[model samples]
Target: MRSLLSRRFRATRAVTAATAVLALASVTGQVAHADTPAVPEFDDGFGLSQVTEDREVHSSTDFSITVTTPEVAGQHKIRIFLPSDYASEPGKRWPVTYFLHGGPGNPDEAGTVEALRSDQMITVAPDGGRKGWYADWLMQDTAEGAANWETFHLEQVVPLIDANLRTIPDRGQRAVVGLSMGGFGSMHYAQTRPDLFGHVASMSGGIDFGNYAVRGAVVATELNLTTAWCAVSSSRGCADYGPVVDSDAIFGSPYPVFNADHIWRSVNPAASANLAKLADTGITLYTGDNDLVENHTADGVDIVTSRLDKLGIPSRAVNYGDGSSLSPTCNGGHNYGCWAPAFADYIPRLEAAFAAEETK
Candidate 1:
């Protein structure tokens, strides 16, 4: 259901050469990718049923894999940056890190990939698709290139990696981190499936999708922008994993009348069953002092930390304030300037978590 806002948004966007390339790209948007399948296909639940693309990079193995899966409108993609000695050390099994990118992910996320690849673990980046919301659609689009992102990542992608790669393949052996939309995805996925990830971090993620300072600000505005793209700058350009859809397609209608179920609330970190699982997991929250979304991004971090106060589950809360040596954001808007440092701040923590699991 492309609305007037969508049409207007598409018409007014600044699609740069790199961004035009992004529109039909992978989850990271760093490499060239395959077109989404016309009809959806299911995986066997064991591993990748079919692989359409695979290529290599330098000392570390950087490859993008396109696989057939019923969860998405087209083939889901996986971008892997393997350890430098991944080829030489066949016998050694390594821990894995899952990186979730933002709505339109940082264009040059190569640093993060390189860091993970060289850091002593394998890096796994899965395609979240355009405006996928990192959640399965509440109502199916039933159109070409529709997406079932939740099933695609948790059901299809996770097993696909473990089955094929030499991963420790356990809860403590794996970590998940994301930027912005991915921040939401990382936390949501970590909470929803407590068995899968040992460590979770969100970089400038508007995590309080349910109610931060004001209710529904995340899904209604930020998440909504990803769907219709009403306010994206040409510099940012769209990053494509699949077709862009409206917020309704992912959660529910943007307007309040349609969200009586509080789908957003259900997914919030403060909700049910959270008392136990999250207490066992290491959680990190990051947000720049000045975010483009009126700094509400910080509100979610505050809310989650405050709510979890009794449990003492959250390990770290890093707010790169207006005057900090680490990711100093002197009141500037949301940009990559902060993410790189935030990512750097989290890498060691991820390594520490992975190391802890190795001992047990």
Candidate 2:
């Protein structure tokens, strides 16, 4: 009888040891905090086979995915932030937010990634082509084919996310937000593809792409390398112009709205023609009052908001701070510092818009 009791006791201790180890694992597996969801690295929604991921270039919450599309040159890299439960709950669907980075920036910027690290939504940042302006380039070539950044995002990236990830996959569940060049991109994409995104916000966005002065300044500053090949050796009659200024790649040359042949009229958000299209969608614009580039940033917001008002379309435009919106606290000055706060403030409003649409 004593021997029998010892065997039972030993079994109980073994079970207890296993249980304790499991409890510790459960605690450590939580991604952020105890309450945070623990997503799996691979699931029906995402896996190593569907979109190739770079493990080396990742944060605690973010990772990179690469895919090749017919629209642009070579393979494109998209940085994605999956919520904690992303892998843990395979049956759940989440809203998606396409975050466009500013000009001269790419998907790997830590500051931008940090801004979105804790977001519960599935956040995606595409390769903005550095200075691709998120538009289809005129005829830039890659080994695969002509570079079409716009088509890649609209046609390829969105669908891939929907197919591979457990996304809501509806117009009302998606939002687009951007800063600087990305702001222009968000506006362009939202207006062009109203069926894709429900809420659109631009923080110090290049909204008024048709503004000649602004476009000129942007082209000079961003694409400053003057190439003689553009002016002297163009069989297509394309001059050595700033990508937006004279090249047919963007708005088709001759700068801002020529009365006779305004090629850019339809796409120019600042113009009455394009602003009219955003009437039904949730629209918001923000800029720092002290932004030196207010002529293009805050002023663009003012111009577009005024046009929307005239058209009887509801929109919100805010110019924050009275002095140079430069912050000693944040990076400030038309950069990620200002952009981070703008995003924090804007996201709640965007979520409210989504909720309102669901009720409707």
Q: Which candidate is the best by lDDT?
A: 2
For model 2, name the residue pairs that clash. 37-84, 39-84, 39-87, 39-88, 40-87, 40-88, 45-164, 290-324, 290-325
| Number of backbone-clashing residue pairs for each candidate, in the order shown | 3, 9
Provide TM-scores for the models: 0.75, 0.74
lDDT of 1 by residue, 98-151 (tens): 888775543225444345554488888877754566887786754435467888
The global Cα lDDT (0 to 1) of model 2 is 0.64
> CA lDDT, every prediction?
0.63, 0.64
Candidate 1: minimum summed lDDT over ten consecutive residues — where? 33-42
lDDT of 2 at 15: 51
Candidate 1 runs further than 4 Å off: 1-47, 51-60, 106-113, 142-145, 212-247, 253-259, 272-276, 328-332
lDDT of 2 at 330: 43
